[model samples]
Target: MLKWLRRSEPKEVPAATLGPLQIVKPWARSSASEPDVGGGYMTVVNDGESDRLVSASCSAAGSVEIHAIRVKGPALEMRKQDAGLVIPPANQQILKPRGYHLLMRDLASPLLAGSKVPVTLVFEKAGSVTVDFAVEEPGAVGHVTLRSS
Candidate 1:
């Protein structure tokens, strides 16, 4: 006598529906013994076929502003970017310290190391993506540790 065995088809896992919005290398300033000025950094990649990234906001600090750090006459100056940052198609923009970054002012609480900071990023085209920034030691070298959702 012979027996027959049957196999079932494998189910497919759906892809992420949040199209084209990619976040990379996101990091927040390390916790300081005293509450001082700090900022956040990240890179936004827009892989979509069109332009995106109209604005960005966060609740981690009293107010989040998009600013640019420029070297003006041997002095570093941060200026508000009123027009907002833009992430063009297939391009990327960086938000790093002493440069284009998220100005986190009036920190509500101390960002302890080995902890996480909740940050919600809002985009005009891609909607919103929330991420937790890992806290590290102050004065640590910049590294790529965060990614987009």
Candidate 2:
């Protein structure tokens, strides 16, 4: 009797550390009814002593703004945060749906699911790191996965 041994498949982990910056779980998707207004969520961990997200830009939309969602008397409101998002040392900030997020308005074209959209996140210390956001369905949560890089 001969026995055969099986080998485990290797998992392809994403490359860690893109330049001086480390991006954690960046995700973006379009909203229902209004496809032009896309939403982006992500976390950035600044390994360096000092750094913060100054601004963000994307070719997928005409304008991108950092916003926060609030509920006032049963009304859902989204407002722009002029102070820019901050990433503290050894800390993380979460950008999620119906919360703090990157509001992509006036999309140049339609963004479909499974498609990748290029976005550039500018940091005050680490500079700019460009990454592709995997698009998903509207109101879809927890689809965005980010590793160090």
Segments of candidate 1 deviating more than 4 angstroms: 1-18, 30-36, 50-54, 140-149
TM-score for each candidate, following the candidate numbering: 0.71, 0.76
lDDT of 2 by residue, 1-149 (tens): 99998988973333235544566667788877576788988766555565667788997688888887765554557778777777776665778886788989899876788888888888776777787877887763333322221
**Each candidate's lDDT (Cα)?**
0.64, 0.72
Candidate 1, 1-149: lDDT as tens digits = 89887887873322122478667767787435345545777777666855445555556577776777765564566777766677777866778766787766777775667877777776767787676666666663333222222
lDDT of 1 at 66: 73
Cα lDDT, model 1, residue 45: 68
Deviation of model 2 at 10, angstroms? 15
Model 2 Cα shift for residue 36 (angstroms)? 1.1
Cα shift from native, residue 14, model 1 (Å): 18
